[model samples]
Target chain A: MDNVDLLISRFLGGKSSAAEREDVLKWINKCPENRKSFFLTKEIWEASSICSSEIISEETKQWQTLAWRIDGLLQKEKIIRRRILVKQFFRIASIVLIALITGWSGHSLYLRIKSKTTNVGYEMVIASKGQVKEIFLADGTHVWLNSDSQLKFPTEFTSKNREITLEGEAYFEVKKNEKSPFIVTTRTHKVKVLGTKFNICEYPEDKIIETTLSEGKVKVLAGDKIVDLLPGMQSRINTETLDVRVGQADLDVHTAWIDGRYEFRDKPLEKILSIVERWYDVKVVYPAEMKQMCFSGVIKRHKPVNHLLDVISALQPIEYSISDSEIILKKIR
Target chain B: MLDENELVRRISDSDHEAFKELFLRYYRPLALYARKFVLPESAGDLVQECFFQFWLNRKSFIVHTSLKAYLFAMLRHRCYHELKKKAALQHYENDTLQRLRYEEWRYFETEESIFYFDLIEKTKKSFDKLPPKCREVFDLSRQRGLSNKDIAENLQISQKMVEKQITKALKIFRNELSDFLPLLIFCVSQLLLVVIRKVFF
Candidate 1:
């Protein structure tokens, strides 16, 4: 080994004096090979580590996976909140759907969003079960919060961002604010928009979040994955698996809920039951893991809960009984 | 040195990349340190537990020392718990042996263990980069503990050539390790590797 090499080794160990450090730097600048060796030694494990390259790589991959898993966990915890209000029902979306033809502001919602001023800085808008509420924000943006949903919004939009967090389902007709883009954050994603009309369905009880845009544009940012939605597109996010799927939005089917109607396009019976339970404020207990039994069609919000159940039973080979908040369903023999 | 304060700030905001940076910096040394107290099989788990707790609870830390010192201290305590747990599982007659083993580990300390593992790994890598003929001669002389004359006879080269090849390998190692600090750091690691292999197996 060269004399400079010894000096360099001493420098790397942090045991070198100022004179030794200067000598190492002088040697490094003397040739590129010396510099290369120096830098390589900094990152490269000792000679012994060379034999364990496979193990090191495997360990690196394991650590990376753990970090990502923790990232997903943190996001999930932020989105799923527990407390909910049990309030009297005020059904009014049937009229709001009719008012849809009268410009953006006049697109009446079934009066579901009830804004209760909480603290000084944030406003909590909650839509109780069996109700849908329309909210007109300070910035002329209109929001329709679905039943059993919660939205936390700042009392006033900051000069830079019109930000709000959603937990269930909502349709936003964001008043065009190019300078202040509207951002809707769920547990795992941030949907950014510059004055757009879109419906977001993210009920905690459901496994997937469905976003269907009717007008303008929105971009959903989930971790490193970004999905852009055009007016005619729908992006479905599987929360548990953290997968994003994009397809044509049967716009009417997804937006039907905002219009005070239940529209299912061959959706599974399990999902239909959950939606029914939330809409009418009742629990439907069916067979465990019943995803194969899919139901389709539209039911107006005003339809009697029993009538809907009867319609369901008649169409599928299923029988049901209702007792208080519970509706038990069994397949016909 | 990695900026612990900056990493803590980024980690508090739930930055995956920042956490990964810390993981990469300390993982191997931490794993090797844990191995001194626990079996090689469980060493990884112990190191992983230490890092997981450290990264997950970064926001709650009140750092009074360097990040490396903090991690070493955390790893030290982890190894103690691991040994204590292992002691709990073993028969009482072997209890003294295990306790003495823990003391031996503690006396050796963490810095020397990390320094040794790194030096051995670096030296082995440097040695491996030699030309095939040079590597054969040097490996026979140093690794197989063959005399220079024996290495020359085994490799069908002159004793002088064997010494030359070994010198060439040493020269390359010294040059490559020049930027590294403290030459003596390289000695114990190679010795310790053999000792560990013998003891563990």
Candidate 2:
């Protein structure tokens, strides 16, 4: 390489021995044009350095902040999605479990009743440990008796219509017969059906009468007033006013007793306790103020009453006692 | 030299630690050099992107040359592309302004009426008259502080050729301004003569 090329290489490498550095300075001094070129190069280099440093630092900071914000948003979305999935899974699982249990219990109950039958004319009696006797009518109709309840019906209906009488809550599935209507007579009211499924809830201690229709149609008569119910419809008769009001019926809540699943939907705490008392064959007592609380949800009717009480106590402050065939509930404080 | 070759081999094998070591070794100086060519904010990014390109094309990299030379060459090429882009943008802006003026006024003329305007315009015109390659060599040496060897390496020419080009450019500049030099010298000599005459006449 020539002298200029060697000098250029040293400068480009940014390396120079003390003697070589002096030689480059002397060369620059020998020519005015060379001096001007060197000064211009230095100025341009300095300007570029200043400009790039400021811009690079600003861009890096902005990019980091953007990345952090994106990470935070993604994390929040993941948490929300996880919570929704967990809740949805639990809700669906509970419904499925309830259906399976109810089906199994109903099948077992049907088998037990079938085994006890002797012949066509003989009475087929089914009695629980502390509950009243029940019987199934010949035309695929069912009747349930509450504790201390007694129901009597012929094993076969030979005449124009099928009829039965009940002392307490009894659910019925009346055989479809347009020509021969089915009738269920209670202490205060009579229910007439034309091939419909319904529940009649009447107790001596409870003055109000409730009848819910699950399918087809039923006519409820109290005094002179008559109420006709379609599928998924209910009627409540107030004994004091002698008035009847019809509204939407929930089969799960109204007919759960026959399936061994007692369900409540925003019912008053007093009413929930009353149903529990009859199903578990127990007595419940609570302060007047505590009766205002509402209860909702379903529990297996065969489960120990204490288990159900524990669920309630977890949600609110309450206490309970079990004595042989009775259960009592009261506010904790 | 053996260690450098080994590091390059490891880097080609996708070893991140070796690559990181290489990056740390060259980042500061390359960034400083790039700062002389681009805006301060973009200098670090330019340096990082050059390293990224190096890794991306590692499979194709010829390991015969020192990795340092190859990296510097890549940076230099990127700087040239950046300058070309900036020049195009400037040209586009100037063209837009000129078009806008013509549309509004219907007549646009190049003004030549500023102080020392003729001399500066003449100097620019003469500078533009040089051969393209000669001008490039001169500019890189003068404006970029690149030595002849760096210019030869960057431009793919012999070091002797870069030195000859710079010498030719200096001779042309001296010739172009020779007339002004004589006048300047005569004025300085007259000033010196008067000062001496006043001191010892």
Candidate 3:
């Protein structure tokens, strides 16, 4: 109610003068608690703008179109790989006779196969679509991966670093080794640690990459820039630009998947549905009008798909029905 | 990081991680750059095409320059070709589109946008947690865009009471923050609010 509080409110409402805005900014960033509160207040004020239905649909449509294109190429890559192998099989038979006629040529053919097999040295653990799986490395480090995820690791840890590559999302309880650090390599960034607990969500399909360190210290290296994350902080790396954001980690929200529980604090109805699709392995057909309807709640990952749908319907003004692997969500009239 | 040349070389050998690593590294910036020249909607499509080409040609692909430079050159041609096909070649000279001015454009183009996007989602959640009177006052000022005096008059309360209720709402949001960030960057905290306000509001 005091003048400073009035200034803060005015600044939040876009009515504050330049000097007053500076004062509010300084006060808000003076500590974490202030930043936290400013975050909440801004959210409340920005709600209506956030609910813009057109922008949400357009953005997702962009992703869907690009994703379908990628899927087309990925499937094509699969067939092409097989075709190459078949052609090579025929060539190898003819190659053997030619190689015998020329000793050096035989040695070269052997080297080519050796190189190809060596390329396959990297082992991949794929959690098929709609699957979550856990793996423990030889070093006692534990990793739990989310659905439709892939972890590519070497058969044995190299002398320099223990490195593993992640495609979708995973949580790690790394074994401490001061001499040899554990490194997680994603498509865009690398997380390095001597030993630590953290969760990483860097789906190639998603434009953003998130890293939340639960305990100890981990260094997040993106490009030439290296960011060190302490326990309880998350680094959000943008795939398109140079901006990397460091903010308070919601440990419960980020780590909830470890217990098969998914928590959405306040997510759009459509956003939740996409997650539901990944969580329940179902295709969601929802009315476009309800895209702006936002909800917040916790849903266990293993519960029946309808159980979640039922709970959501009871809480919010939306109706849903499921058949086979498809679920349709309609606005309640 | 291994120099991008090494990454691209490894990608040529069909290393999915390396390809992805390269994709994650360059995709955002390339998308942003192409967006400057091409129609906004076509930017992402063009970049994806570039990546698809990069993947298909990996076996024979060899880059003599930095991978960053390589990607930029590849996308530059794609955007040019796209415009030519549309017969909007004059768009290439678009004074507004030529220089990206990404410092301001980043809020819309970068991954950091998610932070603000999320604040909107969490805003409702946090607002719902405020005390009843405080939430009511916040809705009036924010959703209804009423002045503090107007809100006070409509609610039949003192202006000071309205101020107090709004302050109470902010306090609730602050307490709800998940403590991932240690709040050490004094500057980001300040610039963040300014930027989020400019962006979402």
Q: What is candidate 2's lDDT per residue for A1-333, written digit by digit as tens?
A: 246545633553355566776666665556665554443333222322222334345444534443454346457757988999999999999999999899999998888777645332435344433454445577877566555455656677766767677666777777788888898777777889888778888776667888999999899998898989988998988777768889997887888777677788787787777777766767776678878788888867668778778988888888777776666667776
Tell me each candidate's i-RMS in Å: 11.2, 15.0, 8.2
**Residue A222 lDDT (model 3):** 93
TM-score of chain A of 1: 0.63
The 10-residue segment of model 1 chain A with minimum total lDDT is: A82-91
RMSD of model 3, in Å?
Answer: 56.3
**What local lDDT score does residue B42 receive in model 2, on the 0 to 100 scale?**
61
> What stretches of model 1 exceed 4 Å from their correct place?
A1-120, B1-201
Query: What is the docking quality class of candidate 1?
Result: incorrect
Minimal lDDT window, size 10, model 3 chain A: A47-56
What would the per-residue lDDT of candidate 1 be over residues B17-126, giving only the tens digit for each residue? Answer: 88888777777766665664676557676667777787668668766766677777777887888787877788634455465447546565556555545555577677
True contacts kept of each: 0.13, 0.00, 0.21
Alpha-carbon DockQ of candidate 1: 0.06
Per-residue lDDT of model 2, residues B1-201, tens digit only: 238888888877766667667775566555655554566556566667677777667657777566766776676667657656665667734444322322211111111111112323344455566689877886676546576678999999997788677656544654564453333333223233223223222
Ranking by lDDT: 3, 1, 2
lDDT of 3 at A8: 65
Best candidate, lDDT-wise? 3
